[model samples]
Target: MPTAPALSILDRSRTRSSGSDADAVRATVRRAQRVEALGVDGFWVAEHHGVPGVVGSAPTVLLAAVAAATTRLRVGTAGVMLPNHRPFVVAEQVATLAALHPGRVEVGVGRSPGFTAPVRRALGAPASADADERLAELLDWLRGRGPVTLRPQVPAPPVWLLATGEGLRTAARLGLPAVVGGRLLRDVEPLRRYRREHPGGRVGLLIDVVVADDAEAARRELLPQAVALARARSRGEFGPLPTPGEAAAAVGSAGLTGRERADVERYLADAVAGTPGQVRQRLQEVLDRTGADELLVASTPYDEDVEAANDARLAALVPELVGGLRTAG
Candidate 1:
């Protein structure tokens, strides 16, 4: 059997209803410091423009903080949305970070547009922008194949694609590693096909995971994120996470429609939340199903102390998953 996969964290800088957006960003940096001490492999931040629930709109900027605060943790974006910016600029930002951090920075790119039409307009991203073309352009600049050489010409950081359906094809075609999550995980055929086509390209599974003393405690920690997602689907706006008590009240409130309740349940069902033993079993099953090379935990609970404890437990549970499970093939 293949060895256990490497483990990493992707913090979305998810805002809590009790805190401001600035607090969330600072918390992400602090969390990076804590997790680096915990001996995890890598720490990544995300980019989400105009989302109430997320404050990580500038991943490169945030990663710089994370990289500086931690001596050993591999820090990167998960990622910078290709459609929202010029490829040359993105390359410059990544190259700058790599020059400063040396062998510690990784770059993940995605094709997702702004969260809403107005946000997209503000970003000047057209509805029909060619993300594949933009991704190719970004790769060209990063590889020194563009018309103008990328400045500060340091070694290009490793690049990953955040794979959805089209993204899976793009990553396979380009022979790049893919970070896949959500609904994509429910079907293993695409993941299998990607590995087959790329012939040993790395596959990283991104999922919501919370670890606590027992199953129910972990579920409570996961509830706020689930509630945020459910509200996003029903109300068309993803707001900051509520506390566990707030989430429970919201779940049971008469104001919550049946559809919203169903959405919350569905989101919770998709996550992996339990005691260490249960999480380990669930993670092993996911790895077996997807043949993944790495695991990226994407859960950001409402409480920082609880989140820190969760990270510690997760690191302890999967000691073998800390680093160097398998290299990108």
Candidate 2:
């Protein structure tokens, strides 16, 4: 068993209220560079299509840019949605990236289709598409079992399932590692079952983890994302991130309905936000309960400076959370 869990970041390239989509994409690249300099283990980008709140639609393309901008930083998609793409094409793209970066590229794939009816129509993603079968086919191509061999012919990069619930079973059945989040983080039975079923398979947790001088300040940084989730759930549209002050104002001015208020609270409740010591304790509890092999921080604050600082703070705190290595220094 590994002595320490790997720590990484997943940036969704979220567009802030003050910036354009282009700015958001550029900011992702910059964030990748910043985290790499802080000794972060890896950087993953997300895929979203026609979402007003996110700009990371083309994950592989953005990953290519991120890879080019940083040396020694493992880059990947968090991931590419299989239902919206052809398995062969997805295999080809990841193969090319692996060829270019050698040991520095990883590919994670998901079953999600478009986020809404309009986006689904735009992508022509059929609602009935079989994601499990699609995932099997994608694996075949990546493993060189397909009719046509992928060009540049590099070794297949590591593949991780971006999953929850049934997806966990699928990953375990296929003997692949999984990155899971949401309710799965809170409920350990499924995660424990996955570990038992696939003893060699690795599990990663995706979470909103922030560190600040005080617990309140840390949670305040997560308010914007919680508000975005609330809006998405209640109004069917997730707008760009608002400043913490703006989010608090919305809560105060009856901008959010009772249901939306409850949604925001629920979202915040699921996040791990606090001072460094508090965050360390909460994360350790989570890691122990879930037996995760990796921790993927997925927090994005409205302030870029705060985001960067939090990344640095998390990096500084990671050494203390590693099991036997906590007291090494």
Candidate 3:
């Protein structure tokens, strides 16, 4: 088996129509606690704005709660969208958090716009002519290499770019880590380009996986999340994740559209789902293919109990696969 890389998490803190957002936030807090107990290297909170289906609108505040709950896990965003907030304000927030937590803090940034046009208008930030230029501006502000003094004056924590394409090269030039998102499942060319540009630059992979007692149970747990993503991608509708029963009923319903069925199946087929041993083997396969140094496991099922089981099984995979596992960072 390929070596198990540093394992971490990227929690979306998905909310259900059946529950309040507060329930999701509490679940997120408990999740970081579990990550610490499981000895995972880091816990990353995602940032989504004006999306009813996702409750992690403010990563800084959510990360603060997470950092306070766990002493061992490196807490950070998966990331904060640069276009949504002023660079200096973000720098201050991150610096303050890092000052409070010291070495336990990290920063990750991205250029993703909000889910819809109204959201963009609400944030009052237009798309940058060049995201890289904006990213450069943020880095300069955070690094304080310029004449102006950045307040708090705390040591800047490690900053990672959630990237692909030229963004990988940009991160390389900046001498920082690149988090390859789940969109490009196990793609290595970006990582290769990054290393070729800046040898020894850190690379992390984020992908979805579900480990259950059996294949049927695994698919059952993965079904709703897969359906939700497909709906977002194919229909541009951010629908609440359906219950597993709802998903199954949709599959066989007279109301099921051809396009929807295909989209749902595509995501379902793409997810890694099986027994614990099988999940371990497949994840190692991804590691072997990508040569990534770390893995940010991204699985946000609507049900907390399902999520807890999935996380436990995931944390156990590497120890059994590699004979023994050490704490990750």
TM-score of each: 0.95, 0.96, 0.92
User: Could you give candidate 2's per-residue lDDT for residues 138-241 as a string of tens digits?
Assistant: 99998888899878688888999998888888999999999999998877777777777777688888999989999889878999999898999888887899
lDDT of 3 by residue, 188-251 (tens): 5666677778776777777778999998988888778777766677667666668888877777
What lDDT score is found at residue 88 in candidate 1?
94
Which digits, one per residue and each the tens of the lDDT, describe model 1 over residues 26-59?
Answer: 9999999999998888999998888888999989
TM-score, predicted candidate 2 vs. hidden true structure:
0.96
Worst ten in a row by lDDT for model 2: 320-329
Pairs with steric clashes in candidate 3: 41-328
lDDT of each: 0.86, 0.87, 0.78
* Number of the top lDDT candidate: 2
> Which should have the higher TM-score, number 1 or number 3?
1
Off by over 4 Å in 3: 1-3, 127-129, 320-329
